[model samples]
Target: MIPTRIAVIQGDPRARVDLAVGALAPRLISRDAARAHIALAAAGMILLGGDDVHVDVSVGAGCLLEIEDVGGTIAYRADGRRSSWTMEVHVAEGATLLWRGLPFVATDGADVERRTTLHLATGATAVIRETLVLGRHGESGGRLASSFVAGDADGPLLVEQLDLDGLAPEPGVLGAHRVLDSVIALGFEPETTRGDLVLEHSGAIARHLGAETHTSRLDRVWDEWVKRARQRTASHVDKPANEAAVGGN
Candidate 1:
């Protein structure tokens, strides 16, 4: 059996020490470097032709980490085997991470499964976004199974799952076209005025890309709907104990 792999390349600190604070602390990171890191990591994984892929990322406190892929990840048609990608991120307190992975293009007959789990400690902030493009231009194949989970110490903060099978592009699913994207922002609440600004920015992007827009307060979405949903019912109530038994706690 061939082994799966994950590559990580973090940036160096580039902050000056405050005379009062004593030691220098990393404040911000370069987005260019971040994109390059993911690009190289994914490129290496693609070359390996493995049966599975897993990536885990951790950012220490007071460090700013930004990650982006060079371009879309294309998963070719798989044989009988399945390909999987997993990302686990831990953003410590007083840190920021702008982690966004580009659109993943799955060609015909491809069975790719992807999951992302983010753990945000108090005072940490992160903005994460992912886009998926179903089936390439031609030579149609298989569906993409994706799951996203973001949470803190208490429980899940957000969860988005996708099981797009046997479904082509339509008005509701992936819009009139065949591309869909979602974003999540966690940690400190944005001010009312700033909240409006964020919405405006998202609207501009939606208009530019010709994609449908959906935005909600993460808290309200989780409390009113997510917490009461079908999968969520089992997730928050029953899974933690099971996870603890498995040493996942």
Candidate 2:
């Protein structure tokens, strides 16, 4: 059989809500799901038997938007064969975008590569969080390679690169840990208040993660926060590479 590829693109209208996709279709969250202008679009994207998946997004001027996933995204590890996923985002001035990506979990022994790039214009605000998990609890077979780059109109701002050879452990990377996640949020500069909101609201995020893991409870909620920071190799306040930083993590 063959795999299906999806593309999506979004643009901002007069008041906001301008989002689109290239090939992938999105499931919008119920208006009752959240507050004004905020929308959650997620889909269970499958990597077909013989194809890859790609997603693209754009935000127009004077718009405020938020994108999130319904749940963790599972990736099937291909043996020596390769599979990939890519996301490209563009943000215009006076516009705001919050992209909360779900976790990516690789199957054992599967070979996979994924990349995400974001471009932002001056006065354009955005926050993005990406999480990747090496392997599931007990399953293991293939390899996972991933990279991310974010920049604005001026130059580069943030970059993350990772490579794992096999199901086997990487000394400093994953070590023996099978599951890992990363969250990166940008913007919150002039406002400054948003960063604090994230910290206070992070309790829900921590509790949610605790619920997800279930069995082994973390001694301190703040511990998970630190782990996520290490995985992405970005400070709490740093959004992609294009914008100037404002606060501390």
TM-score of each: 0.60, 0.63
Q: For model 2, how big is the CA root-mean-square deviation?
A: 11.0
- Model 2 steric clash total: 31
User: What are the candidates' C-alpha RMSDs?
Assistant: 14.3, 11.0
Q: Give the alpha carbon lDDT tens digit for every residue of 1-249 in model 1.
A: 232222223233222211110011111222221121122223243412244655556655554554555556777767756677666778776555555556676667677888888888776666665666666664443677888777777666666687764355434554544455544556643333223323322111111122221322232322232222212123212321111111010
Q: Which candidate number would show the highest TM-score if scored against the true structure? A: 2
The lDDT values for all models are 0.47, 0.49
lDDT of 1: 0.47
